[model samples]
Target chain A: MARLSRLVLERLMRYYRFLTETAAKEAVETITSGEIAEALEIDPTQVRKDFAAVGLIGMGRVGFDVCEACRAIRVTLGFNRSYEAVLVGTGHLGGALLAYPNFVRYGMRIVAAFDNDKQKIGQTVAGQIVKPMRMLKPFIKRRKIRLAILTTPAHVSQMLADRLVAAGVKAIWNFTPTGLAVPPDVLVRNEHISIGLAEIAYHLKDQAAC
Target chain B: MARLSRLVLERLMRYYRFLTETAAKEAVETITSGEIAEALEIDPTQVRKDFAAVGLIGMGRVGFDVCEACRAIRVTLGFNRSYEAVLVGTGHLGGALLAYPNFVRYGMRIVAAFDNDKQKIGQTVAGQIVKPMRMLKPFIKRRKIRLAILTTPAHVSQMLADRLVAAGVKAIWNFTPTGLAVPPDVLVRNEHISIGLAEIAYHLKDQAAC
Candidate 1:
């Protein structure tokens, strides 16, 4: 499978949430791609094309049930159960991520946090202890956590990622300024605040200029 | 003018920095969109189109000078100066946003924080006190702050936004889950962590599924 563009990934999440809610309501049996398009404000052709590319096919024109489609997407997304993630940096941002409530909404939770700071070490955030960086491997293995959130600084992002990869982290949600260069096998999604804010500032300027 | 996408806005900051370095070297005079395309790994035509859409046109063959293009983008982005923002919600995420150093890098800085928590009301983070929520209006107005970073919980987001909007805030970067329905004139951006994380999870699954 080719890596989906960030925009596509963002929209796919909405589709999943809509499907989940529709499933809960018990109003769906067979859903046409056009129905999804109508609900999501996307082109119907796009709906059919994207799902077909995902290798899921509903009965030709009979369509797919909301529950079945969501199940397929959920399974393909490895979201059948809660995902365990470890925070690589126990800094302010990392602490905030631990406290963020939305992770549990998607059945994902931070299982532990790692830091070299003595003051934060041994402290618990969101009920997960701030462990020494040395404990990363054993804790991740024990918890079967393959997802890691990298909130470390720009300078250390690469080094930290190297360590996490060595410790068996398969995916990272990177918030650092550093554009990580990871192996093809590792999955990384950049959500750097610096970039996000910069983008906003740029738009503000455009608005003002207009 | 067309609305600028978030990704382009963020890249404009990099463009600014690159132009500064180019100017300092005293070697770069006229620059082509192709050069920017090469440096940023963006398509040259795409770069030209974005700039063109903003009403900043480059000569067909002469292109644009690095410094000139940077200045044009800054003026268009309202970053020719600075914007002071206050963090609402002195919780961990708000505190972290207040402390982020790169906030200054893009000419926007968090000047203070506000929260309703009694204990945190007088406490200081990032050298700024956590003020009582009641003072949001006066302080924000007195400081002429129009842009803010909202880190409050979803349930309280509307109330907080209402207060901020009344306080004269025109734009908000919301870190909450709920998408706010602001006035058409007001800009509300949701910084949804769950959606972001879930997108990454889905991508990871997509890669593995195939």
Candidate 2:
């Protein structure tokens, strides 16, 4: 398999999501690359390139089997296996993600959530008990947790990230606006909602012109 | 001014965010292009191009004034004016965004949120009252709302989007998995958190190989 660029991987995820949703409808057993492209507003060639990179072969005219394509993307993206992860900082954003019902469908489960707020500590959020920050290291070590969702504030985000890294977390899904400094060995995916909002703002600007 | 591409606008928003954060820290008055590039993990040339596109000028050695750069990006991206938008589907995701304290900082505000759930109608999520879906049309029309945040379930997303469009929404900040079908004049920005998560999953896959 070729090393996929971040852009390709991100698009592949969108494709996978579209496929999964289509499969759920159960109205179409097979869907063509063209159909997926049209639905996603992506170019057909780009869709084909992404599918080919993942070694998925769509039938020439009949299109790709919905079940097969979904499984292939799941396997390729490592969503076939469930991952045990912890959520740090059980604030509004953290709690919302914790309560997200689709996390399990994506083969990831936030088994625990931690917070430093005394009022929030010991409270169960979305079926997980909120533990003290001190438990993060011990919990990671005992459970062999590999993924950490960092929703800490910007001031302490890097500090918490460093601690998570030292505690042996391999990937940190950052929700803070601050950029995290992690070693090359550790992976970081920053989910900044404002970036998307800004895109909408610009698009709205264009619409206003029209 | 030349029309900005979606890619460039997104990056410019990022630059704006970085500048705002720098200004908030109060440590730096003027920051060099090199510093912005380092902090954002973007190329200095790319930063220069983005700044030029927005008609912003940085000092020779001191770099760009944080406040000035932020204002420039805001004005260029249409963030100079705070937009009045509505939030559809006051579920966990919708409610989280509604409760988000920094929407105004980004130059947008959720003036109202609509939900079909009888139990939720009239209750306040965030600062706005959770109005019934029946009020969506009249509320938007009366307020001349040009933007909407769609966080509705996949099943009703398109139906609701159609109504929103008919109600005069110019743009939709969609958080649903469903791909919206809007007229060319109406814009949609889909913020799928799973895309970011899948990228992290793939990167974790690659790291495990090592």
Candidate 3:
């Protein structure tokens, strides 16, 4: 399969969510592209294209099998395999992520959390005992953990990220405001909280202008 | 100013963050589009266009004034004026949001938090005492609140959103996986955590394919 664009990947996640929800709620065995498009407000042709890109096909008039569609998406997006992730910065945001119930559903798990603060070290947060920063490198090496979630302050995030990369972390889910400098092979997904605030602020300003 | 596209708005926020950070860290009076673009890995021409869209102009040699650029982004993104927002559902995510340090810097204040849980009603989570669900309508009406951050469970999100819309909310920052059905006048920004997971999983799989 060709590389999926970021927009298409996002839409596929939405479709996966919709299909799983529909399958759980209703006894429907099949659904058409039109139904999925309507539920997601996506163009029907685009839905068909996305489905086809993921190697999904529908019958002549019976539409696509719901179970088959879900399986295809799961395999395409690599959600069928579980990923173990270690989270740094046991702050409120980190705690929230640790407690988040949907990560398991998405096949990602936060197996451990780390903090530099002596007070937070050894404390249990959302069922995961917080470890000191000293243990991060050894833990990642022992577990061969490739994914690291960075929620530390902006100033220290870069240093921590360098350590994670040097310790064999290939992917970093950055929740800090500062941009990270990582190698070409490493994937750093920056989840900027302020982007949402900016969008809301802009929309409110636009509405007030009208 | 003409309406900015979503991509442009997001880029503007990045510029704003970079400018503010530079102003604090250095004594630089001006910054070039190339400099901003390099720091963000955005195209220089696109950075210039974004600056122009926000009414910022750079000198031929000296470049744009750092403080002026920050002010322009703040005003263009509606960060100059403060917005009062109410939060629904005081979950761990909600607590993380309440503790987030950047919202105030971006001109948003979570004036209150509401939850239907009996135990959480009177308890304070991150300075704001959690209020009962019954207080949501009256408080919003009394304060004329127009923004709401929803962190409720998926099952109750739509019903809560309906109540929020009736209570005079114009924008909703939804953190649930469930799609919300709001009035045409209300804007819902769905922050799907699963989207990030999907992206990470796909990239990991893509790398393995190679």
Candidate 4:
């Protein structure tokens, strides 16, 4: 298989989501690349390239098998297997992610949650008891948890990230906007919410101009 | 000015953020596009093109004035002025976004929050009292709110979106996974959290393969 660019992979995932949702709605079996492109508002050529990169082929104009395409995407993105993870910071953002049902569907499960707030510590959130931040190291080490979902405040994000990495975390899904300086050996994904908002704001600009 | 691609504009926003954060940290007043490219991991040529598209130029060697570049980006993205927006769900995600202080920094303010939950309707989240869903229409009309931040459940998303649009919302910042079918005139931005996680999972696969 060819090495897919991050943009292509991201679009493929979006296509997969569209396909899966369509399939769930009724009896959708196959869908054309053009239809996916139109739904995603992306060019057809780019969708075709992404399909080829993922080893998914459409039958001329008949389209692709929905199940097969989804399977291929799941396999390619490593979402076919579940990974146990931990969440730090039981604030609203952290609580929201913990309650989110789709993370399990995408193969990442939050098995534990931690917070430094005395009032919040020991409370149950999303069926998991919120533990004190001091217990993070022991819990992660004992369970061998490798993934950390970080929603800590920006002021303490880097410091907490260092602590997570030192406690045997290999991946950090950071929701905070703070830039973390994790080691090369550690994987970090920053989900800056402001960037998404800015995208909408830009489009809104176009709307206003018209 | 040339029409910028959505991807380019998004990258420019990221660069603007990097520049602003760096400026906040030090006495830095100027920066090379090359340094911005390195920090963002984007090609230098692409950054140059993006800069030119926004009518910002750098000296042969002295680089660009950080303040000037930021102003250009802010103006182009329409982030220079504040936008009054409302939240439609007071759940965890809604509450988190409502409490997000950075939204103000980005020129958006959540003026109010609405939820159908009887227990939450009169309560305050992020300093805004959660109103009943019944009050959404009147409040939007009375306040002349044009922007909506939707964090409602998937089942009721489309229905509520229709109501929001009918109430004169021009744009929606959707945090739900469900696809909305709003009129062409109404803009919708879906921030699906799963897609971000899948991207991280894909990179994790590469790490494992290595």
Best by DockQ: 3
Q: Report the number of the highest-lDDT candidate.
A: 3
lDDT of 3 at B53: 91
Tens digits of lDDT, candidate 4, B1-210: 666776877888888888898889886989988898888778988888888888898888888899999999989888977778989999888988888888876778889899999999899898998999999999999988878999988889989999999999999988887778899988888887777777777767777687
Q: Report the number of the highest-TM-score candidate.
A: 3
How well does chain B match by TM-score in each candidate? Answer: 0.83, 0.93, 0.97, 0.93
Global Cα lDDT for candidate 4: 0.85
Sequence-dependent TM-score of model 4? 0.87
Q: Evaluate candidate 2 and give its CAPRI docking class based on DockQ.
A: medium
Against the native complex, each candidate's DockQ, computed on alpha carbons, is 0.45, 0.70, 0.75, 0.58
Candidate 1 per-residue lDDT, tens place, B1-210, comes to: 566676677667566666666677767788888887887668888888767755676876888866677778767676656788878887788888887776675678788788899989888888898899888899999998878889887779988888888888878999976566677666777777777766667755555555
Residue B142 error for model 2, in Å? 0.2
> What CAPRI-style quality would you assign to candidate 4?
medium
The clash count for each model shown is 6, 0, 0, 0
Clashing pairs in 1: A31-A64, A199-B9, A199-B10, A205-B76, A205-B77, A205-B78
Clashes of 1: 6
Query: Which clashing pairs does model 2 show?
Result: none
Q: Give per-residue lDDT, candidate 2, residue B164.
A: 95
Clashing residue pairs, candidate 4? none
**Arranged by DockQ, best first:** 3, 2, 4, 1
* lDDT, candidates in the order shown: 0.76, 0.86, 0.91, 0.85
Regions more than 4 Å wrong, model 2? A206-210
